[model samples]
Target chain A: MAERILVLAEQLEGQLTDVTLELIGVARRLAAPRGSTVDALVLGEGVSALAATVPADRTLLMEHPALRLFNPEAAQRALEAVARETSPWLVLVPNTSLGMDVAAAVATRLGWPLVAYCQAIEERDGQLVATSQLFGGKILADCPVGTDHAVISVLAGAFSSEAAAPEPPARIERLAPPAELDGLRVRAVGLERPEAADVDITRAEKIVAVGRGIESKENLELAEELAEGLGAVVAASRPLVDAGWLPRSRQVGKSGLKVKPRLYLALGISGAPEHLEGMRDAELIIAVNTDPKAPIFDVAHYGVVADLFEVAEALQERLGG
Target chain B: MTLAVILKQVPDVVEELAIDPSGTDLDRDSVSYVVNEFDEHALEEALLLREATGEDVVVVGVDTTGELDQALYTALAKGAQRAVKLVGDVEGSWLSTRALAGLLAPVIRELSPRLVLTGVQAPDDLDGQLAPTLGALLDWPHTGVVVGTELADGLVRVRKELWGGIMLDLELATPAVLGIQAARATPRYVPVGRVRQAMRESTIEEVEVETPVESAPKLSRLRAPEAAGRAEMLTGSPSDVVERILEILRARGLY
Candidate 1:
């Protein structure tokens, strides 16, 4: 094995995840400088087609009935087996829900240094360096992996998926899951859908998102009025959703829906990196926050440094409602 | 049965954080540390479980940055029965998940806790690895981003938050690790007087854990991310700001 970089390709519902391509993009950047080849490992039943879509030098497929769904226990077993065989220089896992669940355990099992939520990767002095956001995105730490073999979970939307050039028809190889898949300590009991109907925020053209600045659950109606005036759908940050003021479908962030709306009217959102990762690419962003120094201002196209309640009422009146 | 809750102190992100002279770390002298928001939720979850099942809840704090003692005391005020602080110079800048996991595995084994609970992720670490790494070191089953948990028939049933609002319902046997995303309710408030009383009455049992000899990754440099695009700030009264936004939206043909 001549300097291999293993990329874990994440997929859902028989389609490759968008973050999977982004991981491949980061892997290419890290590997190209070192004359290393990027190989992708995709585990799922009947996922060979999805694996072939990976833009890496090769795609390793682990297909089995137990691997059909992305329960952590099954995925970990399959990844550990492949990782043991190929001691790759670096393994890139998507920092998605499933990726985060398995990467740390796998790295620990392999005795490799694990870097989580890596935002950027660079080659310094022929060694790999990873940059991660710390202190709620207030600081960036440039970490140089001390060990030769390391596992990294690449943050979603950190790198543009377009940057990864598709290889000339990636070669696919098949592997089998371990024989004793029967005794899983944790079993997936099936997906529990949110109580509300799924309203895909990704398809929304314009959105009005709320955060902790809303102050109280009763104030949600004010945000809704503003959203109704603007002809935009209402959404919220994790705080509001966690408080049960809004359904999970209306939440936007790393652990929530990643949306690229045309106009994102962020009402009182502080623009934590987790939230920014979701709607950073909106064509026009207008933020209303009392704190002028809010990180939301850093990315906003237009901002109002005022209380959200006052701003929402003013906006509602301005929209002639 | 005993439940262990791991607590961490993170920078108070609401306050402005400044880079130190070295440009590789935060200026600790001027900065204030608060218990990690999620870890507080973890402690609250442990307390909730304890309240329901009468299990003993012990808080383990890694006193890496000299801020863990305060958090431990707060945990005591909130409801933890006992607290243990791991005292050592863990070399903050060079600390990696692997190093922290190594330091914790032995301590966890010593406690032999029936369930280990920690925040799903730390603002400082963001890798969301500590709980899972500790589980792997102990070969115990673990789950992350757990939003809801229930106890039934001596098994822990957890609801995991997956991407796009999908939830995964899982059941795990004891001697398991859980990275709590949120508590069932907001952490109960500990009044100032109660906290002061806890400070005087409670003692943090300090255990001098040996720092690992292994070399971990070091943060070579730190830099503020360059602004992606110049933000056109809107100023004036609230009405003027709203009008300005409307004008821009109309110009973009979005309104």
Candidate 2:
């Protein structure tokens, strides 16, 4: 039998996160060439119905009270148990905030080559190669998994899932929880979500997102006026929210809402991978950064390599109609 | 009770980073090094946690950079109780996350801290693996992307962030490892005078260890991303650029 390719199916609040679906999508592509099976490991309390929805060759479901909430220890133990039994040739995990807690532990416990922040994984001339980001997207390294077995944590939004829905798993097996879960050290106490925002950036037609380049809270006025002139909502990157200059509702990134407005006018934001993940799909992007090599230019439709304040001021003067 | 915080020095990216002649690493001679930003957050979180719990704060680091004493002295100056540097054979080499974890696991076991705190990610840590790998090697509970932490009755409570601004509260028993994303407050800036005083008054404990075997993907080559950009560059003065941008918006019906 060919070795299986395993994907750790992540879930929250009874729904499979988008990254988990994306991981399964990548695993299928990797498995077809080797005649290997794609197996998805779904772990959570009341995850049986959720496990059945995984689009893989087989879905291994492990449900326990301790597994209901996200417990890094229990999840790692479950994944280790499954990988030990299946002896998978490759494992795919999402490199999101939740999945990072489990991915490295799997590699450490199984003694496999780990490719984190993986953008793509493929077999090239009989060797597995992963293209991953480094230094927040300044460099890309083509890493060869020298070992036969490897663990990859895929970056969210790297693989588009617009393809027709994959077939649901043909087989679903319920597995017993690992004995170690009974006496685990980590326990989930609660989940808290921010109250609904007054403005949903995701629904906006146009957005003016500010980054560190906006400089200070007082300078946010530049972005606000430009956004108002263009009938766009004002959004921000994580640093502005972290600094308390903007509310969490206005933040965009891996830890904030993803938006795809028609026009994304980015100011002073050197695009980090996290910030790019949220708004890369905007219909048209115009970025102004003093550094020509800022990663934002890679995604922008129009690039201005000058002071953002200067550009914003000029644009503001022209927009006064 | 003791709280262990690990620190490291990374090349400052604000300064230009040139690829070394060898092609496998950066040119170390020209780059300036600073303490990893997230590790500074981890140290600050430990200091805050200690304020309520009154546990000992011991900062540890593997001296990869030759100038480790400056970072250690600054840590001591900013309220750390003891500073330990793992020295000797492991200097000047980039240890893979797995190897770094193996090298530090035994030393951390000796301290037997109630909590081990480190940064969630470093520029080189590809998806931030050190804290989790260390936790697994030590067989302790681990969590990352932690924003806030509070010491509760028998367990430490942490606010672990999920996607889209959602937060979860997790409790872990003693002897846990956490990768701190940010401390409740900004990292305290150590005065140069305090750092100088600490250098004269404080001594860093040093231990010698061999290089642990590294298990990592063979990095084939480093290259800039294929500029898949369709961005039309607007040159000339800011007014000219802004005028062109307005023309683009009008063309796209965005104005």
Best by TM-score: 2
lDDT per residue (tens digit) for residues B137-168 in model 2? 99889999999998877788999988778998
- RMSD to the true structure for each prediction, in A, is 2.5, 1.8
Q: How do the residues A1-321 of candidate 2 rate in per-residue lDDT, one tens digit apiece?
A: 456899998899789888887888787776777788889899988878777777888889999998999988889999999998888988888998888999899888887878888887768888778888877677777788643678888899999654215575358998988899899989998899989989999999999999998889999988889899999999999878877888889998888889999999999888888899999999999999888888889999989899999889988998875
User: What is the DockQ for all candidates, taken in turn?
Assistant: 0.64, 0.75
Model 2 alpha-carbon drift over 4 Å, by segment: A162-164, B215-217
TM-score result, candidate 2: 0.96
Leading candidate by lDDT: 2
Q: What are the TM values for chain B, all candidates? A: 0.92, 0.93
Cα deviation of A142, candidate 1, in Å: 1.9
lDDT of 2: 0.85
| Sliding window of 10 residues with minimal summed lDDT for model 1 chain B | B89-98
Superposed by TM-score, candidate 2 places the C-alpha of residue B243 at a distance from the truth, in angstroms, of: 0.6
Residues B1-255 of candidate 1 have per-residue lDDT tens digits of 789999877678888888889876677777787887888888888888888888899999777777677778888898888899887877354356667777777888898888899988887664446778788888888888988887766578888888788788888877889999888888788887877888999998988878777634456777776677647788888888888888899999988
lDDT minimum window of 10 residues, candidate 1 chain A: A191-200
Q: Candidate 2 at B105: error in angstroms?
A: 1.1
